[model samples]
Target: MIQDNIDTTTRQPIYPLLAAFAASCLLGTLATDIVYWWTADIIWADFSDWLVSAGVIVGWVTVIVALIEIFALRSARFRQRSRAYASAMVLALIVIALILATIDMLVHTRDAWTSVVPWGVILSAAVAALVLVTAYLSRITDAPAAIEVTG
Candidate 1:
């Protein structure tokens, strides 16, 4: 049974915002890769380089923030087994995405056309999928607010 007047306290998580930004920048590289492939444009490759670089940097920052959140709020956030499992899954996905992003960044360092055609695009797509999954999992895992009851 749920109470209509259930009292709860909410604290916003900062890592989700950072994750979204990193995901967007990383995912955007896929688009640029496609455009570069289609138009054979050097500019699009350049865009992919910058976007992937930024995405990788922010991805690392996101990892740091998540670690801080886990340690700082361990008692509040991971009390439930399922919540702990979900958080771990999210962290794993982020790490995987970071790895792909790093490889993609390296790929982007090559010549403009070769950099983005096959390998870069492939890595970008992989990272994009992981980021999407991470975002979705994080959303479902979010507790939103903690309920408190008083006698």
Candidate 2:
């Protein structure tokens, strides 16, 4: 008797993912604008400043990595499956960075809610969470390879 099993390997909707990522990037930019509008301060006066800097850095990194993943997906030279996996991994890294940055910001800005809360931290956190969820979905869809077949 012959039996057939379902093929679990399936590609995700890259366009939606890309769109979401783009939206997040735009939101991050808007958050920066909001922060500038609320808090005129630029220098690192305390831990809050550092946290803001870290958040900015993470946002930038996430944007860059997301773009790279998009490019990888569009590349014709590489296998689609491999590209998907690589993209997922990069996205995961971006999410991790965003989470760390958010935690740092929340911890440092807890005392100055009146000042920092209006400065775009909430918007930034929302964007970060969106990126994180998408990244996690990508990771789940593209599981790591178990073995390497060398020629």
Best by lDDT: 1
Q: Which segments of candidate 2 are over 4 A away from where they belong?
A: 1-45, 65-78, 81-114, 119-121, 143-151
- Candidate 2 per-residue lDDT over residues 1-151, each given as its tens digit: 1221121123332344344444355345445535544665543224344545545564655466445544544433234577557655755655555665555455445444433445445555555566566556555554222111111
Candidate 1 regions off by >4 Å? 1-11, 143-151
User: Lowest summed-lDDT stretch of 10 residues in model 2?
Assistant: 1-10
* Candidate closest to the true structure, highest TM-score: 1
TM-score of each: 0.84, 0.34
lDDT of each: 0.79, 0.47
